[model samples]
Target: MGELIRLEAGVEHTSWNSSRTKMAAGMSDGSVHIYEPLKGTNSDYSCSNRWKAHEVAVAKLVWAPSEYGDVIACCSKDGTMSIWEEIEDAEKRDVWQLCARFADTKAPVLDLQFANCASGLKLVAAGADAHLRVYEATDVLELKHWQLQAEFANAADVREKLERVSCTDASVCWRPATDPIQQQVFVVGFQTDSPQHSIAKVWEFGEAHQRWHLVAELSSPEHDYGRINHVSWAPNIGRPYELIAVSSSNSLSIWSMDIPSGPGQRPAVKLLGYFTDHQPGEVVQAEWDMSGMTLASAGADGVVRLWQSNLKGRWEEKSRVVGS
Candidate 1:
């Protein structure tokens, strides 16, 4: 069973806060609608606020962890990303205010995500220029302030002399492991105009040098999957390493990474499985369950499919929920 709410016709994107108490929807008319679920009701939701978030259509929205309060980050087709915070005004009322705007892309920001790491909070944004930007805030209360930590391409090593490629779309997912001893890492998938550089890359932030480095390339020249649409890092509670699921035009691939024990060693990423029978059209998004044991994918054909691994560690199609 599912709940449905009538919203404006051109709802583009929506995201729920960490606590799942608030939901934000980005509309095609450059407005954002905030809604709170009505208590004691199963399918009722009320719109609490709405605002003009961007000059153009808002493409993506993500909320920070609850520790940071009710804060949201949005990317728009106007080539900018803005961070907003719901703060108490002088009259003891809550109001949404713009905290900061990031316009370094100068191109439409395709995808962005916030990572709540044990060290601190980090924000990652990918744009049409094929560049990935990372930002960090020194203080959680000071949402307006952020430092651009690193910027690089999605190649194996941006420092190396490689072919130039521009990204058409991008998605990022942070490693869910929060052990302070483990080095922080996140994965990025780039849908590039050029097939040679269309791949998923893993980037690691080094605490010693205070810089970012590319640790792994999950694609090869001969079999580079064309135009990755999304990448999700599954939460691992007992696994020694991490697992990542990637969705491209019509296929989904899963990979496992064996993180090395020392610096200067690259992570070994091995393909676990690939599934192509989920839907007949392009796969738009893929998400893992909280336990990282199950996966769900949505396709352009209006179908939501679920997948899980069996006792033999082989992935199988578990169920399918068709859309109306």
Candidate 2:
């Protein structure tokens, strides 16, 4: 095993900035630590900044787009989320200041993500109540001014209004912005008892209606994955269709989504492939590479596997890393 370095507090979650050169760690003690990579053969990282962010353990942390400066959003188990910005003081010291806080959440906030939309920067927060709240910054220059743009259920079967469900976790991923057109889209999944609400769903912001609408649902006629463990939207360079990877406790699936050419048309979803080789264990997370060509998945088996398409366009596991 590699050398184990002790930490002052137990880390609950970690996230990387858009550039991936900086890392932010949320601790179990309600603190956040920022790390910077060091240039050396030792391949080490140094903690450059640390601050107490919340009164409770942090549940999720996400960095804003680099164009938005050194800003980060973090949510806690207490159903509250706050935004922080790092500024350089006159003394050349790093100072983190609170920009805004959203504490009206009805349930524990499970996920937080920042999307660079065509108009401005938007933040999406998913709670254990199976609801999503979107906040948009009125002025990009000022990170403090954010108004709640819309709030709605993440799944279609969420019922007439917001109903509290026994939800445990939730995952959110924004679609890659590939063109000049500002299309606000994202995929969300919930871990709950309700099978319909637990499956992943794609949502798009209707500019005309000024609200969100469900565009597509990733499903199959053969099997119904009860609860999605994680969801990842691949980056689209110029592909006619979009790719989304969804992982569950016992299986992993890839779905192809049609790119709508006209407005007001719902995108169609087709199940590309599904694999059950992650047996005898539960898959925890799935992520795509920067190129959007390869996918990486981690399971309870303590293995990190990379998957890619073969010559015949068949998705297959390319390689794997076994943790010691």
| Candidate number with greatest TM-score | 2
Query: Could you give candidate 2's per-residue lDDT for residues 72-187 as a string of tens digits?
Result: 99998778899999999899998888999888888888898999887889999888888899999989998888999988877575362455577799899999878657589999
Give lDDT: candidate 1, residue 301.
81
What candidate 2 gets wrong by more than 4 Å, as runs, is 1-8, 38-42, 157-164
Cα lDDT computed for each candidate against the true fold: 0.83, 0.86
Cα displacement (angstroms), candidate 1, residue 85, comes to: 0.7
Backbone clash pairs in model 2 (N, Cα, C under 3 Å; residues 3+ apart or in different chains), count = 0
**Candidate 1 residue lDDT tens string, 253-279:** 888899688887888888877877654
| Regions more than 4 Å wrong, model 1 | 39-43, 157-162, 220-224
User: What's model 2's lDDT at 46?
Assistant: 78
RMSD of each: 2.1, 2.0
- Model 2 misses residue 72 by how many Å? 0.6
Error of 2 at 159 (Å): 3.9
| Candidate 2 Cα RMSD (Å) | 2.0
> What TM-score, computed on C-alpha atoms, does each candidate reach?
0.92, 0.94
